[model samples]
Target: MIEETPQEVQVVEGVLLAHGIEPRTHWFEASTATALEAAAALGVDVGAIANSLVFRLDEEVIMIIASGAHRVDTHLLGEWLGGIVTRASADMVRRSTGQVVGGVSPVGHPERLRTLVDVSLGAYERVWVSAGHPHAVFPTTFEELLRLTGGTAALVARD
Candidate 1:
């Protein structure tokens, strides 16, 4: 675990403490979609990575905390959101969500962005999320993330 803590560490820590969980912080080298890279870097299971994905819902941006094992069904989400859902570009991601692709955290945005969680993530007892920095990550439970993000848990993935 890296002790320097991330710039967005405050948001994660605040949310965790509000929920009565004192989580331990960990940092990694490369932050990417390849959960294996993060896992190998952190020496944890690939399943533990919580990939913070952002999509354009209509003109608004929406965030989805999905398990590393599943891919988001953007078309389904678009239908649910009643608009065209598309994968946000890197510029769109930072502009709308105030975070980067791999280092996007479930919280600490400029404001609350409408968010959701993959129901499949509930299968995990704990998950790792980006800590507002590409080199930082931290652990939290699936339930905690849903509550913290104020996001509804739904089937956002499919085979």
Candidate 2:
């Protein structure tokens, strides 16, 4: 069972509420670092995991919400956005997202960052995304994610 709301959970709750989303956390025993492991532990499909990835595009901050079953096509994304897309360094991630690699959430960031949601995830009725903490996740519909984030739905990841 999860606590009512931990300190780290507060920000996530706030973000979800502000977005008019119904978010709840599910606790698990597996490491939240990788989708494959998380999926196995949770007994959920890999596609249900919405990975929060940070990428640097022309030195600007960009967030990508991709399906666990896929990997981002940075080169294609670069061409689509007219800029080079590369993985953000750990320092850049900390400075921009205020969360580590495995537990980055698309919302409640330290500051606002550009966002992109993978269109492939739209096929699912709902998707699971990490909260601010590893082992914590919440469910959100694809439409809600897109609306809340004001993110473009794109084929940014390869399935």
lDDT winner:
2
Considering every candidate listed, which one attains the maximal TM-score? 2
lDDT of 1 by residue, 27-110 (tens): 554654356667778777776788888888877878888778778888887777788888889998887656677778888787
Q: Taking the candidates one at a time, how many backbone clashes does each contain?
A: 0, 0
RMSD of 1: 2.5
Enumerate residue pairs that collide in model 1. Answer: none
Please identify model 1 stretches exceeding 4 Å from their true place. Answer: 1-6, 14-20, 30-33
lDDT of 2 by residue, 1-159 (tens): 455665556787788887766668777766776888668767789988899999999979899999999999999999999999999998888678777788788887888888999998898887888887777888888998888778889898655
Please give the TM-score that candidate 2 achieves against the real structure: 0.91
* Model 2 error, position 126 (Å): 1.3
